[model samples]
Target: MKKPRLFNLFLAVNGLLLGLLIMLPILALLLASSPVEIMKLLVDPEVLTATWITLLSSFCALPLMFLLGLPSAYGLARCRGRLRRSLEVLLELPMVMPPVVAGLALLLAFGRRGLFGELFSNLGIRVTFTLGAVVLGIVFIVTPFFVRRCTVLFDGVDKKLEEAALILGATPWQAFLYVVLPVVKRGLFAELIMAVAQSVGLFGAIVMFAGNLPGRTQTLSLAIYSSFESDPQQAFALGTLLLLISLLLLAAVHMLAPRDRRL
Candidate 1:
C-alpha cells in the first residue's frame, strides 16, 4: 500500500468527525428509550394509526410518482438543451425551499380560495383537513428525490440498449419497461426508500396542510410532537419507533444496492 499524503490524512480525520456528529443523535435517541416502552407505543392505537397513515400515505404516493415521475425523469435524463436544464431547475424549486414554505404553498394552491380550490370545491372535494391533502404535501416534497435519482440512473444507462430495443420494433413504453427499468431498478428502490422515509418523518408540511387531526391525517412525526407536549415518555417511545423503521429501510436499501450488474 502507498503511504498516505498529508492532505489524505486530514481528509480522513474530517470524515471521521462528520460521521460521529451525524451518528451521535441517532445513538442518543436509541439509548434514551427502552425496548418495552417502544413496543407498547407501537401497539397504542393513536401511535399505531399515525404510523400507518404516514407509511401508507408514503407508499400510496410512490405509485403515483412512478407513473408520473418516471416519464419526466427519463425525458429530463435524455434531453440536451438549455430548456431542459431550465425545466429541471424548476422541478427542483420546491426541494430548495423551506418545508413550511412548501406546505404553505400547497395550502394556498389547494386551499379554499386558491386557483384549483374553487374547482375542487365545485367537485365536492374538501382538501383541507383530509388524507388526500397529506398525500399531496408528501408528493410535493418527495417527488424531487424520485425524479433526481431516476434521471441520473437513466442518464447512466447506455442509450444503445434502448436503440436496439427500438430497432427490434418494440414500442417506446415496452422498451422502457423491459429494457430500461431492469437496469435502474436498484436506484429506483433507493429513491423509493428515501421518499418513503422523508414522508414518514414529515412533520411541518403534513401538519400545516393536513391539520394533525387524530385518526384523520395525523402522521407519525406529528404524533411525536403531540406526545412530546402531553406525555414525554410516550413521545420518546414513538420517536424510537420512527427511528427503527428508518434505520431498517436504510439498511435494506444498502443491501439491495446493485452489485456491478450490467443491463
Candidate 2:
C-alpha cells in the first residue's frame, strides 16, 4: 500500500476515535431514559421549576450581553497596541479561571461583606443566593464567548462598506445599524445561541456563586447534579434535553460559519 494512503487512513481512524470519546458518554446517558420516563420527569414540579429558572436566567443574560458585550467587542476589535492587549487579556481571564475562583471573585466583589458589597447592602440590594446572582454568574462566564465571537465577526467585515455608507451621508449609528450589523448578524446569532447553550449546562460557577436553592438559583445543571444520585431517571431526562439542545446549537454554528471556517 502507498504511504500517503496509509497516513490518510491513520488520520481518519484517529479523528473518529476522538469524536466518539467526546460523544459516547452523552449518547449512553440519553439512551438510558425512555420517552415515558422523560415525560414523567417533565411533569414533575421540581424539574419544571428548575428548567424555567435556567431559561429565565439565561434569557436575562442574553440581552445584557448584546448591550454591553457588543460595544466592548467592537472597541477591542478596532483598537491596537498595549491598551488593547491589556484589555483582551483581562477579558479572557474568566475563560481560563476556575469557576470556583470566578465565583469567589464575584462573592468578594458583591457579597455582603466584600468590596462594593456594603454599597449594595446599604441600598437593600441583595445579589447573592438569588436569581440575579445566577444571571450574573452566567454572564461573567459566558459573556466572553459572545464578545470573542463578535470581535471576530466585526473584524472580518469589510471596513469599506461602512466607509461607503458614511460617504453616502449616513450617520455613524445608521451605518452600523444598517450596514455592519446586517453583515455579521448570522455570526452574532450563532454566538448568542451558543452562549445560551453554555449557560444551560453551567454548573461549577453558578453553584459557587448562586448556591443552589430550588426554584430560585437552582439551574438545570445544578438540579441534575442534585437528582442524579437519588433519582437517576430525572437526571437522565434533563441531561438528554440539554444534550439535544447542545447538539442543535453546534449544528447551527457549523451551518452559520463561513465555509473557510467550518470544521
Candidate 3:
C-alpha cells in the first residue's frame, strides 16, 4: 500500500511540474493582449493578407507532401537493404537539421545562383522570394514529419491483408487505396494536422529562403516578427492567434491518433 502511494505521489508531482512549465508561458501569451489590440490587428490589411498567405502556402505544400511523401514512406516501410538505411537517414536529415541550416540549403539549391540556377534561368523561371518559394520552404520543413509518421503507420499495417487483396485480383493501387489506407487513415490525419501546425509556425526557413516580402511571401510567423518592434500590441495579438491555432491543432491530432497503433 505504501509503495503504491509513493509511486502515485511521484507521478503526480512529476506531471504537475512539467505541466506548469509548459502551460505557464503559453497561458501568459494568450492573456497578455487586450481585446482592442486583437480586433485592430484582425482588421489590419497587412495582417489579414499575411494570415491568408500563411494558410495558402501551408495548404499548397500539403498536396505535394502527400504525393511525394506517401511513396517514400511506403517504400521505406517495406525496404531492408543498406540503400534503404541510407535513404532513411537522408529523409531524417531535415528534421534534425537546424531551421536556418535547412533554409540555407534550400537557398543554395534553388536560388538564382544555385545548383540548378543556369537551367532555371534559361527557362525564365524564378523561384526565390516567390509564393512557390514559400510553399517550398513549408514543404521542406514539414515533409519529414509526414513521411516518418506515415512510414511507421504503414509498417504497422497487416501485410497479409494487402497480399490477400492482391491475390483476389485487386491491383496494387486499389489494394493500397482500399485496404491499407482505410486502416491507417486516422494516423495519417493526425500526422497531417501536426504537419500543418509545423508549417504554420515556420519562421526561420521561410524568412531565409522566401525573403519575407509582404503580400508576396510574408507569413503570419514572419508578420509577428516584423510587428514586434514597431507594434508590440499587434505582435501580441498575432501571438495569441498563433497560440490558439497551435493548441487547437494539437488537440485535433491527439483526438485523431489511432487508438491501436498496431492497426
Best by lDDT: 3
Candidate 1: residue 3 lDDT (0-100): 92
Q: Of the candidates numbered 1 and 2, which has the greater lDDT value? A: 2
Greater lDDT among 1 and 3 belongs to: 3
TM-score for each of the candidates: 0.93, 0.93, 0.93
TM-score of 1: 0.93
At residue 100, candidate 2 shows an lDDT of 87
Kindly indicate the candidate among 1 and 2 with the higher TM-score: 1
Poorest 10 consecutive residues by lDDT, candidate 1: 254-263
lDDT of 2 by residue, 51-140 (tens): 899889999999987898998898888888999889889888999999989998999998888898899999999999999999999899
Tens digit of lDDT per residue, candidate 3, span 101-164?
A: 8888999999999998778888999999999999999899889888988999999999999999
Give the poorly placed runs of model 1, Cα more than 4 Å off.
Answer: 1-5, 260-263
TM-score of 3: 0.93
Rank order by lDDT, top first?
Answer: 3, 2, 1
